[model samples]
Target: MPRARVVINREFCKGCALCTYACPRGILVISRDFNSRGYYPVMVTDEEQCAGCGFCAQVCPDVAIAVYRE
Candidate 1:
């Protein structure tokens, strides 16, 4: 399987969890920590589990996510 890299602009995330719902792999979660904007950020539990499907990026309202295959 191809390895995927998921990069999130933590500061821009609003803890919407849209990506979490969009992920078929179930690798995403909303973090308890707040960002500079005082909003919770979503995090990828494991890049190794990412499928590079780009679903997370597509659902992100902030466009704070990017996915690349490695």
Candidate 2:
């Protein structure tokens, strides 16, 4: 099975947490670190757990999440 790699654009993220809720694998989380705009960004906690479902990217309002399968 192919694995997924998740990338989050910190500059574009607004800390909305929508992607966190959208991830079925529960690999995404809100980071403790802040972005350039002082907003917390979403991060992938475990890449191995990702299923490449692309749910996080689809639900992101800011289009900050990207998922690549390998």
On lDDT, the candidate that comes out on top is 1
Give TM-scores for every candidate, taking all chains together and pairing residue i with residue i: 0.93, 0.93
Candidate with maximal TM-score: 2
Q: Determine the backbone clash count of candidate 2.
A: 0
Per-residue C-alpha lDDT of model 1 across residues 1-70, encoded as one tens digit per residue: 5498899999889999999999999999999899988999999888778889999999999999999986
Per-residue lDDT tens digits for candidate 2, residues 34-57, read 999999999888888999999999
By how many angstroms RMSD does model 1 differ from the true structure? 1.6
**Angstrom error at residue 3, model 1:** 0.4
lDDT of 1 at 6: 91
| lDDT per model vs. reference | 0.91, 0.90
Question: After superposition, which runs of candidate 2 have C-alpha atoms over 4 Å from their true positions?
Answer: none
Count of backbone clashes, every candidate in sequence? 0, 0
- The 10-residue segment of model 1 with minimum total lDDT is 1-10
